[model samples]
Target: MHDFKSNPQFQKLQGKKVLVTGGAGFIGSNLCEALLDLGVLVVCLDNFATGHKHNIEEFLGNDRFTLIEGDIRNLETCQKACNGVDFVLHEAALGSVPRSINDPITTNEVNISGFLNMLVAARDNGVKRFIYAASSSTYGDSKELPKVEDRIGKPLSPYAITKYVNELYADIFHKTYGLDTIGLRYFNVFGPKQDPNGAYAAVIPLFIKKLMNHESPVINGDGSYSRDFTYIDNVILMNLLCLTTENQQALNQVYNTAVGDRTTLVQLTELIKKYLSGYDPAISKVEIVNGPNRRGDIPHSLASVEKAMEMLGYEATHSIDKGIDKAVKWYVENQHSF
Candidate 1:
């Protein structure tokens, strides 16, 4: 894993206070842990809707860690979390395309309305910077090989629409309120601490869990769908860079936070099996089942990180192979936790 403490750039945030919305969830929890390691104060705001208490359990005892049990959809809760915070790492959202399709009203209320609430609170509280989790789904139906920041297509799902709106809102907030912000359009992020049992669990953890039990993992399509499978550490690095970088140009912009490579679902399954077989050889024999193609799923997704590289001095530290190895090991050893 990349060590933030050893980097002088990250050392700049040692005494700052950061409010991480949805800080009890997978990516949010990992960001909290990283911030704590850098000797920074972390305020975690979560409602335990999709996030679990156990995820942030270890940080509860830390003096610098403060847990606010609240939902982002509540304006007062968002205001309370932003009070006296130097920066806002807004990670709260209702993710998953299918879940949004089933209930877009709620999704819109949370992802869009709640995001606006955070912007208002951040503006009112005089937050120095606002960094948020954008999504790759914003690429939508664009058939481009490498999804660039400026180029996009019509949203294919309600969830995609919400994420794209977040970018627009953040941009408007910056221009209208002079509130510096950075938006990270994350690709398929996966790693440790991600839930593997939820209906909306990400592909990596879900597949790992199934293979660990010697069960057949189901593919939503013919296994040809591809994604730029980014690791949590890379996402963490991008957030930290956005927080610490002094370059003024890096602010008020959205950058692709990914490895800039693609992997087919079939290749991903094979990789998972290979890694898990190290723990249980029988997993290698388990067959992969194919189901009808899932709605709102893009056939292929890739990213161009040239912008992040040029603007934020970003470099991906984990590739798909290295990431899968570490993720598989984590799931196998920490099977009882989930």
Candidate 2:
């Protein structure tokens, strides 16, 4: 979307064999698609615990795209997926603070143990780089505005703890095993193919689905809490930069992957309603109800994308408004798939 073909680093990605863990999930599926577009051979490893088969169904017929139905928790599965892969984009994990709180054991088993398995497999197989999906939740109770990479606070939730542990493990792997790694700490990412159904669905797609169905969407608080609502394409660009950057300073470091902007829940709902109304006028009148804020919910979250810009030449191609418009259009066109 950002003229990737023009970037020489991106040009180097062509014909490389890359393995994407959790390639059937929302973000992973999107990554797989972007890599395939650049003529990169993609091997997707997904257990489908949360990832949907429908997400990667389109790529099933592509010769360059291979999907391995396996779990990262199993060392052998990770080893098999990493075999002959040039790079690894690890996106598998149990996401959601509330869900992790409900079952910390499974979250730890997957996010921490599975992550370790992948790292060991990558190291054993001689993969050049391992780029992972880190979380802004790792910021935890830090009341910091525009979160920077070096500064972090104590984790608040089980999910947050697991993600923070990932950064630690990755750094250790680089220092001890010489496995080149980069962790992209993603903020509240949202866009097409993101699931809107489930107890732990993210706010954007969940709100979009509710508004489309003319159901009253609940706001967790007074709708004042905000997030650095990032578009999927922006995330894709960051992953490409992580995969292709030649700078030694950029490797084995964590960077925030966000647009350096924030939008309140109130503003987000208005934007969604405004866009969806074009497809169905009834969406304009969808009710928004306020509920008590849940435990461990951050009041506000933003990111400093300066590090990514300075180090990787990363630039966000879409603002929240533009991203919402595109996402709403997709949902409208494919509402029957839900």
Candidate 3:
């Protein structure tokens, strides 16, 4: 019953100094915006490897906002960003199943080595909290309806393995090094600024972009594969909850940050078409190619939010329908540039 839309942990951030690695990426940028809105001094670190400068361009002149263009793999850069920062939200990673499958070595280097560097830096700086973006892909190959944190299966892809490794290292850091860290297992997060032009684009924005161009969007599988599809606002709430929550029992743990619901790609497609009809009815008629099942694809993924609710006080406001509309509108406004 913990409410996220009007969060109490939010007030705990005012006057705090925060460093958000990968703060230029989609989720990271959204997080940076929220932190700044709370009157917190925000520092963003990114390599531009997969992040866009335009995402954080609006904050360039703000005194409270600082952008550090660097890779997290460099220990020195990590230390520099962590210096004098109160909370560190580490969101930097190569985030694509296909991309990781195509080049796992690069993924491992960034996700594993880079994560370790941040951990070392945060420990050195004595940061108050170390919150990172973990993925629900950690529930790989599990046939469960709703994924629970304590229970997990073998990682299906390199991306999944890398994320699971993050949780492992974080737990070790807490027990071995005495640094308080929390991991948020995000399930299919989508929203504004999610790059739709990339070869490995996420579903919502990529499909919206393709439909806007009057092109057929590929539906990687038979369209039956479902996801929890948490929205950016929900994710932003969870991140804030992790940063400021004082529940001693919740420390040194991971929470599944997602709406406890399911929507298949076909259902999502219909929802998008319905929403875009108001903007441009032509999008409703766009073609969708039903391709074969994708490699490393799971049939369904739903998160059991009982833990986040009981401990972290996470309450997801936007369901898939409402979240998709917001995402489609953002894509419609921005699709012209690319």
Candidate 4:
């Protein structure tokens, strides 16, 4: 979507075999689709626990696309998925801070132990690179304006701890096992195919659903807390850069995979309504309510993209406003299914 074919750097991945774990999830499915567009052989390994089959239904017919139905928690499954793979994009993990708070045991098993199993499998299989999905939650309690790659604070939740542990594991694998790895700390990524019907769904899609249904959308706090609100296209570009870049310094380093911007919850709601109202005027009249803030949520979060820009020549193609406009149109067209 970002004219990936024009970038000669991505030509290196044209015929490579790439494995995308959690390939049935929102972000993973998008990556699989893009890789397939580049004529890359894609292997999608998903247990369908939190990820849904609907997300990957379209790719089922692609001859170059393969789906393995198994859990990452099992070492055998992880090893099997890594076999004959040239590169590994590790996206498998139980996300959501509140869900982790409610069920920390399952979260730890899937996010930490499952992640370790993947690393071991990738190392044994001689995979060229392992790019993983890290989280901004790792910046817990830092109160920093623009989150940097090196600076972080104590984890605020079990989800945060699991993600931080992922960075540690990747670093160790690079140093000890000689495996090439890169970690991308994502911030509030949202777009099409993101599920809005879940107990722990992200704020943007959840709000869009409520407004479309003509129901009042509830804000978790006083509507002052903010996020970087990265778009999925930007995330796809960063992963592509990490996958194909020849820069030696970029390897084994973590990057903030986010737009260098922040938007308050209040501002985000207004943006959503502004876009959706064009299709249905009633959405603009929907009320917003403030409730008690959720636990394990940082008051404010933003990311510094300088490291990604300097190291990988990364650029954000879709700002939050442009991303929201595209996402709202998609949801409106697909509302009947949800």
Candidate 5:
């Protein structure tokens, strides 16, 4: 296995043509920025179904970047986006448990159908490698303290099932069609560019946005549920590392992309409150509104990144505290939009 950090193979993707599906969303935008910084030619595809255009507006003039406003649910769109692309980073999907619970068909239409569209497109286009956005929700009902790769429980929600299904289809595509693919099962990833004003936004960004606006954030399930919130930079590094590594053993596999540490909702709220106080001591007045248990919500989630460490030489540099500090600062500066 190639050491992800130490190997010279990291530079192999420097000038490659990379396609980032959903390149206008939080994670996809961040990934696109990283790729642009590395001198990679990036073709960003998004339908704006759930992604915002402002996310990629900053890169509009870059000679190395091209933005195609389209959806992956359409196979022709996926094929056109994959044409001449050297590698694929599939991050496009409709995400959120509550949203999925309310509208399972839309989630299925986008997540599963859209994912299949990209996989087939990448395969037919003869892309160098296919890397996709898998979810930690695949751990599902498995009561393991720190989730490992091979073991999983029944999916709790339609969203979870869609993500887990991505992994399954990706595996099948690789084995049956002789393709190379890697799945990064992200665990509550958060950082700059994360959307906070949405009805189904993720917790960290949402809470930070709420606190910045002097609003009391809800503490679902008494704020006891914990998570391993991974930072975007770490995710960017993992993707870059995985895309270039020549380890045959690492292909056709899924790896947990997280810091491998758990923080409870109460503790997370306290941390956010502490950071926000720097802006306005009065902002500290934001209190938790304890609510009924959320449907399809897991009690706790932490990842055992041993597989990533051993096979991909992946190491998380930021702790949950560090990620929160950075994310909170971004939300503070962009409070009005929230």
Candidate 6:
């Protein structure tokens, strides 16, 4: 969507084979679509535990797109998906802090054990680079503003601990196994195809869906909590950079994939209302309710994109305002599908 063809660096990915784990989920599905557009062979490995079928229905017919209905928890499945792949974009993981807190065992099994399986599979199969979806939750309880890669606090939830373990495993893989790896520590990524229905739904999509139905959307706290709400397209760019960049200094490093800006929960809701109002003016009048802040919730989360920009030549094409407009439009048009 960002005219990826304009970048000569990305041109190198044409005709390459890529395996995107969790390819039926929000971020993974979007990545699959983008790679197919570049004429890259895409193998989507998903178990559909959290991923939806319709998310990948469109790509199912593409000759270049292959879907492997399997779970990463199975080393054999991961081994099969990694075979003949040029690079691995590992996006599979059980997301959400509350969900992890609800059942830490399942989360660990998928996020940690599953991740190790993929790493071993990729290493054994000679995959060129293994790029993974890391989380801002890895910052944990750290109150530092504009989180940098070098600085991090202790993990606050089981989900955060699993993601931090991903970073550790990746580093060890690079050091001991000689597998190229890059960890993209994503902020609050939201966009089209993001599931709005579920107990562990993200704030943006959940708020958008409630407001669209004129339902009262509840905030976890007094609405002072903030996040570096990043758009999906910007995230896509970060992955493409990690996949194709030949910069030796960039490999085996963790970069914050974000807009480098923060928006409060209250501000985010207002912006969503402002954009959705264009389609249904009544949405602007929806009421927001306050509830007790959930445990393991961070008060504020922001990112420093300096590492990405300097090493990967990355630039965020969408700010929060621009991204919200596009996402609201998508949800409005696709509401009937939901």
The models' CA-based lDDT, in order, is: 0.95, 0.94, 0.90, 0.95, 0.89, 0.95
Count of backbone collisions in candidate 2: 0
User: Where does the lowest 10-residue lDDT sum fall in candidate 5?
Assistant: 1-10
- TM-scores of all models? 0.99, 0.99, 0.97, 0.99, 0.96, 0.99
lDDT, residue 321, model 3: 89
Off by over 4 Å in 5: 1-9
List candidate 4 segments past 4 Å from native. none
Greater lDDT among 3 and 4 belongs to 4
lDDT by residue (72-94, candidate 2, tens digit) is: 99999999999999999999999
lDDT of 6 by residue, 12-67 (tens): 89899999999999999999989988889999999998899999999988999999
Per-residue C-alpha lDDT of model 5 across residues 196-281, encoded as one tens digit per residue: 87688888888887887789999888788999988888898889978888789999999999999999999999999999898889
Question: Per-residue lDDT for 334 in model 2?
Answer: 81
Model 4 gets an lDDT of 0.95
Worst 10 residues of 6 by lDDT: 1-10
How much is 294 displaced in model 1, in angstroms?
0.6
Ten-residue segment with the worst summed lDDT in candidate 1? 1-10
Question: Among all windows of ten consecutive residues in candidate 2, which has the lowest summed lDDT?
Answer: 1-10
Per-residue accuracy of model 1 over 19-121 as CA lDDT, tens digit each: 9999989999999999999999999999999998989999999999999999888899999999999999999998999999999999999999999999999
Clashes of each: 0, 0, 0, 0, 0, 0
Model 6 score (lDDT)? 0.95
What overall lDDT, based on C-alpha atoms, would model 5 receive against the true structure? 0.89
Candidate 6: Cα lDDT at 1: 56
